[model samples]
Target: MEDTMALQNDLTPVVEMKGITKHFPGVTANNQVTLKLYPGEVLALLGENGAGKSSLMNVLVGLYRQDEGEILVRGTPAEIHSPKDAVQLGLGMVHQNFKLVETMTVAENVVLGLKHLDFIPSFSEICRRINTISRQYNLQVDPRAYIWQLGVGEQQRVEILKLIYRGADILILDEPTAVLTPQESGELSRIIAQMIDEGKSAIFITHKMEEIKRFSQRVQVLRKGETAAVLETSKTTPSELARLMVGREVLFRLEKKICCPGEPVLEVKNLCASNEAGRPSLQDLSFIIRAGEILGIAGVAGNGQRKLTEVITGLDRADSGKVVIQGKDMTNRTPLDLIQSGVSHIPPDRISMGIVGDMSVASNLVMKEYRSEPVVKRGIFNYKEVAKSAKEKIDAYNISTPSQNTEAKFLSGGNIQKIILAREIGACRGLLIASYPSRGLDVGAMEAVRLQLIDQRNIGNAVLLVSEDLEELITVADRIAVIYEGRIMGEVPAEKADIKIIGHMMAGASLKGAAQAAAEAELGEDGI
Candidate 1:
């Protein structure tokens, strides 16, 4: 045992966690898990959703206290009781959701929570320092720019810069590629490689198998709060890693075939809507979605996505244009009319539009179908019937909750999405509009939701999937439509689109013209 311990120390793991265990009220998060990270290496932590990947990382980052464990830095035991303590120990984490102050400048956000605010606030010095660090790490960002002005990718760069600025040598990235385009993801991978080359250590927390293959030297699989296996990336395939993590052979791709689309299930011509400020949001937007097809709407958030959903769902009326659903004109229809017409929506903000946060899960499950039979009783309330129906839906959706009567807010974000998905997909007969459906889900939960949506489309249901995630659009959508500045730029077949061309379009370029340029550029020297 002494010789084995000496052999392990020779590897010089920067961060070592031994026999870590954590528990919530009813669930054991980490069950005597042991993980180690070596300097100058990218260690990929692979796991499914709800597999305790985040929880274990949280323990290392001082977000949660471990019930039992010993943490070692440089092979010496250390106690990290808070984020500050973790930072003191050369540890930093970039969370899945960025924690930037939107109104603050990039430099301000990066420098936040650190002691020594210069008496005069050295804005210039701070910017210079950030720029220096940015160049050093190949993380380019305008530190003087406001947080709100930066793109999602840029915002992520800012997060990385923050840790670099804080003097952290051991960095933990949690699902960093979830919202990035393929091009951006590639850039990030290169950045990680650069870091590794510079002798910095990193623990990459992600469910993306492709990333594990591309970025990591070694891969560690975590299942149900324990380390299942750790192996060299070059020696294993994604299928093998997936099998180890899931304890079975999992299908990485969906078995989908070509579809024969029917007549227009949803038709909109010259539609207009407004934002919260009562200003024009979606301006003269026109599109058609046929039954048995998944039309993916791709764009940055707040770029008329919300208004488009509101207009179609009757939460807000379009200023103009006809909304014909199932061959019937339901223009400027009431919310009730939209629901009766077989239109179900998974809203952008699940907490605000999908679930009543303060209400019981049972009530929320039946919120959309309270007026329908079996749940309603001659204009009277049927508590028993509603509860029973909710239980059935809960079971069918595999929602994780102690009981149906549990408050919606008590459940995790992923479980809340499941409830909404179950309700909308089961109730709607013609069309389903899912916006950011898998936003915060972990691997397992995301796969389940994606499969559910694909299943809906396969059954001849028209699905309008609006998302900022381009990879999702590529995988699940038959046709991808780029939306910019409140209008549809152009539509393209999923197979014909590339990440670079599509990313340019998302950044407000003309899609048709850009596609033409891309084609021309591919033609070679004479074409140029």
Candidate 2:
């Protein structure tokens, strides 16, 4: 990057934004933001959640209109009012969430709304073009396969193909690797490199510092709504980037203490469950989450993690198993029964399973206790007590909202996560099942969630922590269990656990096999 400064001065900027401003309902998303992108380089936009990276990119792609700014494309001023306009100008964006018809083929989805093409495209010709571009970009997705049949990583490839097929040379990718596995993330890096080799410029909006160093030449740090600093990716450290993002010194690792195990509070023995398509999800899965310890379940997504959490929380039925909690058989028990049995659950789909969106925050807070004492003296609800508890929990969780009566839907992802964490951890009586507690949160919020889980474990609660983040498992959990397809691959002590060993196990190597091949895995770096 330091050596590339000469080329930056020689080559003209492909895209430039000067003094951009944008405002939302209660906050200014961006204020006087400026940026420049030259051809054949990847510029990493680094920031925390709600730091206006998305807003700036949205404006660039015509998904949002800046309050005031001048956008120049190839040294000429341009007005982009819609996605169609942006596409015609060689600008394209691959969002975090894919916009694809689940039942449609990849080829069909690619040629869906191409107004510049023939009125009707030949299916064979479309497939041929998809194959060619996919090979050229290192994005290998089956053109004939339906979107629903593909995994998250494959689906993202289709999104990238969509942009390339539309004749876009300037790409904007919003958290492209967030939903991908470690292996898939490696593939994505290769693809981006190919794009750069072909003289195409890319703007990667991400919070991952390692990715910034590996992929990008320059890094742009945004805090609140203004430019904090611009640094060469190779020169800056992760700690400095984190400080720029949070405006304070940050903790890189979790400080977890030893946990003294007591009797088992949750036992899932000989469990079996089916997916929505009647396929085996969990097969003979048996595990014990003891009191005063965190058992982290690590795996790639869709590898029976959801079923394990649901079956334990009594949200989904198990074909055959015993869910014994605190010396009581609670298999096939109703969700309310499990709740009453002192089992608190923080589900993966927080908005759908954790809280009611349209309901008041205060009402949602008291949902677990509305039928119990203090909050419910008679058959009617107690608004006063509920509000008191909600206010206290909101403050304790550092939830920023106008009031307790605000709708839950209005909160950001981090705030929503905090609300659920506060409720579940505050009321945990025996066992707490937390699944993907920090899925989409920023670093600060993620640190807070992990600390809260450790706090609960310290207070004598059996916690089953499920997450896709390997570093997080190495941080807070006392024991890490690898889950491959359905069954547990193996368990390892979290103290000094090697990530390469866990990665090998995640890729379906046996515990003993992984240990034997640990040195080999390090050299080859396979199964990561």
Candidate 3:
């Protein structure tokens, strides 16, 4: 303990949550949680997936009402029934997913719900205020630019600015750096330090042990909907924290041998695709992924990430491109055709592309294999056979659910990801195109997903991994390539790469010089 109570001598505790408890129909999300946030300190809420970190914060932020609890703001019990009330009480939250209007300008989003007598937001005044705030907090964001144009990191800065502009003293950030590059994460760290200097308190909810060590003064570990341990960040190592969080030691990386890539398994050449609005998504994109290797694509969201997946898997038609799958031309084929030809794809939007929310687990499990025998015969589905198959997959994949009839929406984020993994990875043969496979998964689920991907690579299957999570790329990817503005900037062996170099490339920096310089260095065995 860091004597957090003693640290609040003259300064009042900004937020005090005592005896908080919440329960879903079949799950206890939080149990008797007690937490106090001081005037100017960062408290990192540490937990694995399904660990109740988000549940506790959701209660505080008014997304979910606590079954039993008292929230005291500035030593007074405050009634916060909604997000609006939380904002009125000087409490703000930036969610794991950024909530911003794509068409709106930065200043507009910052002042979104506030009352303005005039229809206009006073452009010059808002700009001046935004500029001053940016300078004061080291939260640099262009106030005039459209939200959709900025990177994921920049968009999050705008979210933070929204809270600050609303006069928030107690800020809650959920998984703030889950998608950021190392450089951007470092910049965010500086910004948080500045917020504390200005006498603001922060609650950082994250699973990253490294971030807890770097930022928080005190760490609170939540396990299975309860506070398992609370300790000083300086007094705890990542290993100790991991042990407490998971109840055992968890191997952070998958050990594997390095092997030369076999013949090209999946090749894309001059791929041009369209966005949702019918404009160009991918423009002259070209890349090649080899068997027995993981080719990681690093890019900001909407740098043709979904479109790239669509074009390769035949969900969307390419204006022009050549997609070769195991010596067969798969360009412009139907999605079913691609799947039948042994291309297992874990699409980006899990709800739309991966699983059907209202559908039963068994129904979804055999969705892709409806045409195959035992699942389909004479246009009739074998429900008994499908249920058996689903049960087997669920047990093998460790999906935590009651039965095969359990709705996909009833499961947690990690379990949903598990279903996708079990379906796609289990069906794969020649290629696996996984996009953001571990987006909302807990650390243990993330590790399992990575191991499965590696297992596929070991079995001589090519994997195209597109994700914004840099750590996942570094951890599991054999070769990393930067995709900027719908083109491959450069490729590097993961073992020889650094975050600095890769991040710069991700931000659209040219890699011509570095690629030329590293031509000779790219040789030799460097297992990623």
Candidate 4:
């Protein structure tokens, strides 16, 4: 640590933003924020969902102009008014949602906007250069592979390669590991280390505390568009960082009551389904969720999680097998049929699937219940009752909004999620399926969502929680079932859940096989 600090003191920062401020319609996204990135180091920018971390980085990358303050590149004042200018000044940013042409090949996408390139560049030469950079940084990707043919991780590698191809020395990755599996995240850490070893600097923006510790040298915390604290990674704890980000003592552990499962609320037997391309997705899958327990489905993304949810909720067809709800066979039923049978869903894509963005909060709150009494009187719509009910739900769920009539799209991600939870949890009669409920939310909102799940379990309502976060599954789920390639790898009680074993299962290891491997490794460590 002493050597690192001493070395930093002797060199000028590779990139620096001094007192930068940016404003939106009614909000100050960034307020006089100062940030510095030294050469050969990874600095983590930590903040809540709406804490202006992205806004500040946008200013550095020329996506948004700062209202005040100046930016310096290598101790020289630099003007970056557009992305092209930022690239010319050796700056690059990879957003959470990747900017890639799905129909184009990796090499074509990499050299798409070079001013020096000819109208029809030499494909052979471009592929060779991409391969060379790929080898140098260990970022492997097929230059000829189309973006649509690659997985999420591979697409991300292409994004990095594009920046490196353009001579970018300072990289900014925004939530780089949000959708990656555990193994993929470790690979990214290696890539970052390689970049730093080659004298490149990075600003990693993330809210996950574990990622901050694992990937960064120093940590900078942002709260309410202002710098909260900047501390060395080795000298800080996750609890301290969480507290700093939320401006309060954040609780990492929740108080969970003992689970007392009741009769089966949902049963799927020998279920089969296929993806849109007619490829097998869920193969002979089966599971049972009881009346008073939270059954968590754990796996890497792109596994059969989405298909399983869709089939069970009547949003898609099942090739073969039965979906029984409350002792009635509901195979291939319509969404309304499932809803009437007391099945509520909080989908993975909240903006597109969970709520209507352009509609008023009051209107969205009563969407599912509008056909029932109190909301509809003698076949006539009741505006007064709808507004009254919306206000009650808003207060109960702690949804932050200016008015019940405000557009749902205008609210922040966390508050919008609350609106969904408020409606679904209220309408839940027998079973509730929540897919990545707390994803992309702040620490406070995450805590609230988990508490709601637990409360549902306490009240004897079954909950099926699907999440890629093993930590979250272990915290709130009573029993977790691992799925890989449309098959159940194994099930483990949450009380005895081991991360290594679960990770192995997620990678396609059966429960027994994973346990045996763990035991063998332990014995080897003991030299037995």
Clashes of each: 1, 0, 0, 0
Give per-model TM-scores.
Answer: 0.81, 0.89, 0.83, 0.89
Best by lDDT: 4
lDDT: worst 10-residue window of model 2: 1-10
Question: Can you give the lDDT of residue 416 in candidate 3?
Answer: 75
In candidate 2, the residue pairs with backbone N, CA or C atoms under 3 Å apart (3 or more residues apart, or in different chains) clash, namely none
Stretches of model 4 off by over 4 angstroms after superposition = 1-10, 103-108, 112-120, 123-125, 276-279, 350-423
Better of 3 and 4 by TM-score: 4
Per-residue accuracy of model 3 over 199-292 as CA lDDT, tens digit each = 8899998767778888888888888878888887888898888888878887876787795689999989888877667787788888888999
Give the poorly placed runs of model 2, Cα more than 4 Å off. Answer: 1-7, 103-105, 113-120, 276-279, 349-394, 399-423, 519-528
The C-alpha local distance difference test score for the whole of candidate 3 amounts to 0.83
| Per-residue lDDT value at 165 in model 3 | 83
Badly placed stretches (over 4 Å) of model 1 are: 1-9, 101-108, 115-154, 257-260, 272-284, 298-307, 314-320, 327-340, 348-364, 370-387, 401-416, 439-447, 458-460, 467-475, 484-489, 492-528
* Candidate 2 per-residue C-alpha lDDT over 1-528 given as tens digits, one digit per residue, 9 for 90 to 100: 123366587777999988999887667878999888988889998877667887899899898899999899998998998888899899989975567888999998888767665566689998998999987877888999999898778999999999889889999998888767777888989888887898899999776778899889998988888999888888889999989888888898877777899999998899999988899999899889899989999998889998998888888999998899999999999999999999999988676578888997787777888778788887877778898999999988777566788798766555676788888888899999998887656677678888999998999999999988888888989999999999899999999688988888898999989887898756677656
User: What is the Cα-based lDDT of residue 61 in candidate 2?
Assistant: 87
Relative to the unseen true structure, what is the C-alpha lDDT of residue 231 in candidate 3, on a scale of 0 to 100?
A: 80
Query: Which portions of model 3 miss their true places by more than 4 Å?
Result: 1-12, 100-151, 258-263, 270-287, 298-307, 315-319, 348-366, 370-377, 400-411, 467-471, 482-485, 489-512, 515-528
